[model samples]
Target: MATINSSIVIISLPAIFKGIGLNPLEPGNVSYLLWILMGYMLVTAVFVVTFGRLGDIYGRVKIYNIGFIVFTAGSIALALDPYSAGAGAMWLIVWRVVQGVGGAMLFANSTAILTDAFPVNKRGFALGINQVAAIAGSFIGLIVGGLLAVVDWRAVFFVSVPIGIIGTIWSYKSLHEVGTSTKSSVDWPGNITFAVGLTAVLAGITYGIQPYGGMTMGWLNPWVLAAIIGGLALLVVFVMIELRVANPMFNMHLFKIRAFTSGIFAGLLAAIGRGGLQFMLIIWLQGIWLPLHGYSYEDTPLWAGIYLLPITIGFLIAGPLSGALSDRFGARAFATTGLLLNAATFLALLVIPVNFEYWEFALITGLSGIGSGLFSSPNRTAIMNSVPANQRGSASGMAGAALNAGSSLSIGVFFSLMIAGLSSSLPGAMTAGLSQNGVPANIAAQIGQTPPVGSLFAAFLGYNPIESLLGPTGVLGSLSAQNSATLTGQTFFPELLSGPFHDGLVLVFVVAAAMSVIAAVMSITRGSRYVHVEEAVPEKGASVPQPSTRSV
Candidate 1:
């Protein structure tokens, strides 16, 4: 439920914005759009490690149960939102942060719980199923959100309530911690620096994509630079603090494990590519392909999700099997090969036209999914297995943090790359298309001058790009009905978009492929299959466990 809710709101954004009485694609409102999309992720990314450390100091199961309760409460609050416009958006954002806190708890500790439940050799299969379930939830959430949000926007939030409730009950009733715990005081300085620093960095990146003054992106903005630079400075301080502190929130020494460190880096890169792909595909499907194929704007979200099922099929096929196989064969080969395959898929995507055949699109994306499944579990197993038993909670948290952070970063990195591509080409296309479709040259130029991010957001949120572009200026109303219909028709905007969107796709996919390839390089360098040796704890005194690897 935690992971599923992450993507659910994305597909349902059209209904959500409409229900809240806000135009998210408008220049002034774009920040709201970004925050709504990224806030939960940003919050979760920053705090997962802290919660993981807390789980270590306290108990994993106890923290996880609390997460379910908090998450359900947040869902209820979201469903019951009583305001409209910005106030309503704020309400949702605040509650979403609440949900994020709960999500971090669950994400950080769930792996530790799984590791505790499973033996060493079987850990790969268990983690595989768990990781697959999480990724599947993200994919499935798109379809579920579209269906529920169509009936009522609130239904999207309401849907999580019952599931959260059931999960809460089940976790509390059945889960008991069997894993070792570290009895240490909370590292307050480390916690404060890490949370605040990572939050600043991620939030800065999130806002960095928004327009500032005359620039298409806020990279030039003083505030953005400050946030990013200041965040980095604090992170440096965080590292120093962690090294000196007796009980650090994140164990700095964990980086010594080649498998764990490499897995985290490779996984983080893969996540950036994967998360960016999700958003890009959503825009591609909802903005261009579905409408071009004659689906109504309102129906695009649901259909887009449906079209993405082939990717999930690929995941279902590869995830568990790879996990089981990696247990015997070692993770290095599977993890490296999977990402290399994903890189090939990225290259494949670049060659496909913007208006691609469904089957061709499916085949490429299915291969991408297979690549993801092949890497996810084995990488996770390697990370978990490479850490000492007592640090499992922290290890899990770090892994979760890497995943969420990569996802959060994708919004900035991929979108900025696409925005750069669009900035160069989209203006001419928008101007020419609008002018030809009965809009005045001056007005068309003005609309064309608007940042390309708006167009991307409009399409991503399932709004007809031309309608949103022309509606406010009354250009559509002024034109002859036939001309207006033609401009707003299924075909015009997508056809107008095809060339420029293709340029954007090339930029985005090329970067994504490069990331996958680099991640593959990282995966291959992780040495061999090995699990960390566990030391027996003495009954009375503190046990100093040696951190050493044992080939499994």
Candidate 2:
């Protein structure tokens, strides 16, 4: 449910915006759209480490059980939102942040719980299933959201109610704490610094993609610069505090373990690449491809989700098999090979045309998914296994933090890249197209000069780009009816956008491919299978084998 909620809101955004009487693409509402899209992720990234430490100090089952209740309540609140327009968006964003809090708790401890229950040899398979569910849930949510939003926007939130209730009850009744608990005081200073610093950095990145001061992006905005630099400074302070503290929120010592450190770095890189790919593909399908093929803007979201099923199928097929094999053959080979395959697929996607055949798109995406699945499970298992039993919760939390942070970072980085690419060519093309359609040259130039971010949002939210751009200016009312009709037709904006959008897509995919290649290198350097073993000392004063850190 947590994982599903992370992505369901994305596909249902159009319905939610419509139901709330707001246009997400409008200048006033783009922040709302961005916040709704990224707030949950940011909060989750900021809090997962703290929550994971709480689980270690208290109990994993206890924290997880409470999370279910919190999550269900947040879902109920979202469905019962009473306001419209900005108030409505604020209501949902607040509740979504609450939901993220719940999600952080679940994400932080689930792997620790699994590690406690499964034997070392079987841990990979167990973690594989859990990892697959988390990853696949995002894709599944897209389809589910599309289906549910068709009935009612509220149904997207409502769908989680019954499942949450049942899961909460079942978890409380059946789950037990099996991992060793550590009694340590919370590192309050470390927590505060880490949370504030990370949140500031991420929030800065989020806003940095917006247009400001007549520039294409807000990177030069005073507040954004301050936030990012100040945040990094605070994070450095956080690390210092952690090193000095008796009980750190994150055990910095764990980085000394090559398996733990390298696996985490690889996972972070992979997540950034994967997150960028998902959003880019959605835009490709909904904004351009589906509309060109005769689907209405309103219908594109549903079909986009449907068309992406092959990727999900690939994950389902490869996750368990590789995970099981990794248990015996070691994680380094499987995880490294998976990342290489992932990089290959990204390069393949780069070569594919913007309006490529469905079969080709599906085949490449499926291969990418397979690569992701193979890497995710084994890398996660290796990280968990490298840690001592008492540090499982912390280790798991660190892993979750890496994934969430990478995802949030990806949105800011990749969107900016795409926006930059579009900004270079879109304005002239838009002006030419609009002028040719009988719009006054001055008005066409004015609309064309609008930042490409708005158009990108329009495309992302399945809105009629021409209508949204012209409606507020009242230009459509002034134009001849035939001209207006032509302007608002499904094909005009998309057809004009195809070339510029392809330029952006090429840039985005190339960067993603590079990140994947770097990730593969990190994965390869993680070394062979190495699990930390605790040997009991004999009472007869016999020498016990010290825990070996050597590769198997």
Candidate 3:
């Protein structure tokens, strides 16, 4: 519940940044921009394993109750931020980090709490519902953010405050302490190494999208290279430490289980396939296609959400049903099929133009959503079920880490691909189209030099680029009135960019399709499921190992 509540805040971020008047393109604001956009996930990824270990020491309910309070406090802080634009972004980042900490507490233990409360036979159904709620909440975040960003950006943050307060009180009053606990010293080496390593990797990925001087993207930036390589090195050290530590932060042994390993990989790949698709679709519809089709750019955000409703609807229909059926039929079959369906959907999208008709987009998106829904629930169930009752908390946390990290990683990869495609074609296309439309040769060339990715974001934010392109001194004065009007008209920029943008979209879809197919093949290799340790043993009478009891 707390995690879902935080998701609403995340979805509202683009509008929040816009409302505060920060230009998304400016490097000065990009750090804060990413913090607001990805801070929650970064914080959550850093803290989830740590907190899950803590829950094994302290009571899960105790940590969860505190989480509710912390989350609410963060929400209130975000709503009350006093600065404007860049300064406002800083304030929000601080509070968002706080919220992520609380969210980590909630997410780390939610599945374990359910596992402790439910019997083995009933665990699948219970976790399936929770999985459904989580997916639904992400979709709801978009709609809620759109509505609130329309009314007032602060309202998006404020909405969470009230819900967090209610959840805090409810958690305190109703939830009971049920999970086993131990008292052990914190694993500082493991915790610090893991945090620093993951942060470096994620930061590197995020920065890779930004343009470098004379380069389309920052993949070769020295700092980016250092961060990524250093992060991986630290991760290797962390793993070595884990093997040596008496009380490791993460149990390296968990990967030995076939179901557990396959499920985690499937979750990661599926997330990679779908995570950026939402952002891409929204940009395509609102920033480019919708404007060309006569809808004012300002109205695109809300309509983008509405038009994407079919995808969410498809998920709602498929997730729980497949989850339920998977318990009977087994996860391997359903998960594999879902991946194949998802791959097909992406390939189908590859052939369509960026300015495709509504039905074509709706159908493809809906199909992809169904595939995601089908994969998510069953895959999660498999991961959770593979563990013993006592290890459920850590197991679930590991699974979530893969999903969240893969998502951030996906954004980096897809954005880089799109920007690369645009860099090759957008500048030339812009110059030719502008010159043909009677723009001065020098001005057209200058505007062509402007980063295409920034223009994409401008359209996403619904800004009138003419204001940015021409200063108040009026560059248009030199041009004929007819030329100026044609340049500033709604269709001008969108129409010009459509062909180049379509090329980029096709490239991204092709890559996504290939990845989805690989995910399906991996999922298929998982074979059949097994019941948790306490409930059943093989008919051949082989013994399942019980997790040895230990202090946290």
Query: Which predicted model would earn the best TM-score?
Result: 2
Q: Which ten residues in a row have the lowest lDDT in candidate 3?
A: 543-552
| Residue-by-residue lDDT tens digits, candidate 2, 313-403 | 9988888888888889889888888888888897898788888899999999999889988899999999999988788898999999999
Off by over 4 Å in 2: 537-550
As a whole number from 0 to 100, the lDDT of residue 458 in candidate 1 is 74
Given candidate 2, what's the lDDT at residue 148?
A: 84
Q: What do the candidate models score in CA lDDT, each in turn? A: 0.90, 0.89, 0.76
Q: What's the TM-score of each model vs. the native?
A: 0.97, 0.98, 0.93
In the range 283-385, model 3's lDDT, one tens digit per residue, is 6776777787788755666667778788788888788888887777778877888889998998887778767888998898898878888888888888877
Residue 514 of model 3 has an lDDT of 85
Error of 2 at 484 (Å): 1.4
Deviation (Å) of 391 in candidate 3 = 1.6
The full ranking of all candidates by lDDT, starting with the best, is 1, 2, 3
Clashes of each: 0, 0, 0
Q: Give the TM-score of candidate 3.
A: 0.93
Residue 40 local lDDT, model 2: 91
Query: Per-residue error at 513 for model 2, in Å?
Result: 0.5
Q: List the residue pairs that clash in candidate 3.
A: none
Write model 1 residue lDDT over 379-435, tens digit each, in one string. Answer: 999999998888999999999999999999999998998889899889999999888
The true-versus-predicted C-alpha distance at residue 18 of model 3, in Å, is: 4.0
